[model samples]
Target: MAEQPQEVDFALAAYREEGVWQVQELAHDVLENLEHVSSALRRFPGDGGAVGMVAYDEDVFLLVRVAGPTVRLLLSDITAADEWDLARDAVEQLGLPYPEEDDDPAPAGDLDILGDLGMHAMDMGVLIDDYDLYPDEMLSDVAGRLGFGPTFDDLVGLTSA
Candidate 1:
């Protein structure tokens, strides 16, 4: 078994500054959980989609972005052999746990059926935590944050009302 990835102290510090105690703890727990669950996910052809740590000068850096069930390390100059080694090492040494994969397709991204503002709020929270987003920006301001422009407001108006 491979060893678990050490927590990112800086990211934890960011959590302390930007989030409450519960939020920080939840983020920590989710990330730790992801580490284990990454195993058993189909790799994207060789080590392409394996969830393993990337290093700079052989020192770990960056929390390598994971998309859906895919995992990719952010290291440079690594060969396919090295990548496979890292992937297997993470699964075996760190004891990564994966959610049981089911053949069923995921549901649509809708919570309107919940038919309550509270349920919408809960769904929003789930979306925010699952992916990185600009916390300080409003939905109307998201495009501006991403360098798209203030036109996002116009787009929203056209789509909704």
Candidate 2:
């Protein structure tokens, strides 16, 4: 575990209720681990459960979907486990071994996490493969495809007033 908690660029929970999408800014402390994210997400009354998007240290991002007792996760960079406790917890939850420091940066866990919401696994993979984009950018693109880009952008301060 790190002596200091990881810095979060942003942590948000998005869910749809009554046919409307709602985005909420999650507290930075939710980035502690998967359990915290899941617990926080359960508070939302989203029609299909709630989705959590957290970007840490600008090095990796974690997406968590909590519906009922089921929780699915996706970490943008598997190798991040080497330095981040949240990523390590994610890798463990996915039943994956920690990657070697020299291993290539790859996304791990449920690639089809958002399939039901309309972002297919193939497209998700493509977005993860785009190294040019930061975690926030990738997540913003995801929000757009899922029909809540503007709300996500505004919450993350990506939108100009």
The lDDT per prediction is: 0.28, 0.90
lDDT tens per residue, model 2, 25-77 = 98767666789889999999999899999898877899999999999999999
| RMSD score of candidate 1 (Å) | 16.1
Q: Best-fitting candidate, measured by lDDT?
A: 2
Q: At residue 130, give the lDDT of candidate 1.
A: 38
Clashes of 2: 0
Q: Given candidate 1, what's the lDDT at residue 135?
A: 23
Q: TM-scores of all models?
A: 0.22, 0.94
Looking at model 2, residue 153 earns an lDDT score of 92
